[model samples]
Target: MQITASTVSLTVDDVAASRAFLTTHLGYTVQAAADGFASLTRTDAVDIVLLARGTEVLPPEQRDQHATGLILAFTLDGGLQDQEKRLRDAGVEITMPLREEPWGERLFQITDPNGVIIQFVEWVTPDDV
Candidate 1:
């Protein structure tokens, strides 16, 4: 099926904590929020949803194990290091520090409090080539 939109609902230990990270660090606009769940829309048209376990949106058993072997990656343009540093300053867990690959793309990695990995990247310019 052609997926118009998809949402990754993560079970968080604290809903407000997850919301703060999603909004402040990841730059998501909140579409809706309640005691048990929060729906968010990324400016880049990405669909992301966060559901608190044992709540209306997701049951305790239905909550993802966070070991689903999945990571939510975002291909971003602009200054990779600056962005990575900014995120790091904002309390995002920089699981992998910013570094340039041998192939020459500047990239960095960070994961939210919920263990969602995000990749921030920038293309190598001619001067770097």
Candidate 2:
């Protein structure tokens, strides 16, 4: 199948809160929004759709489900440390402190207002690996 773009839909307790967090901290712009739904977009990242828990647009059985156990990760080419520092300087709490693995992968995480885990990763060539 042909995929032109990608989006992750998150069911959240407070749609507006998640929406605001994406816009304010993650550089997302509102493409569309209503009382219980918001579509956010950024040029360099995946699109995100926030839906209030129990939103009627979902199937009856799925309407009450909230997003959990998922990490929305972005893989960057470089400058991960700078991005982490910027986030910290903006008062964004780091849920997982920046750490590098033996395999040359560096990553960190932050939880959004609705508890969605947003992780940033950068990979390098490990001389030993």
Clashing pairs in 2: none
Model 2: how far is 26 from its true place, Å?
1.1
Mind sharing the TM-score for model 1?
Answer: 0.74
As a whole number from 0 to 100, the lDDT of residue 108 in candidate 1 is 80
TM-score quality measure for candidate 2: 0.95
Error of 2 at 49 (Å): 0.5
Largest TM-score belongs to which candidate? 2
What does candidate 1's lDDT look like per residue over 2-121, in tens digits?
Answer: 987877777666667778887898778889988867788975757777766566445556764432466677767676778877887877778888887766677788777766667777
TM-scores, all models, native as reference: 0.74, 0.95
Q: Candidate 2 on 89-119: residue-level lDDT in tens?
A: 9999999999988899899999999999999
Model 2 per-residue lDDT at 46: 91
- lDDT of all the models against the reference? 0.72, 0.93
Cα misplacement distance, residue 16 of candidate 1 (Å) = 1.6
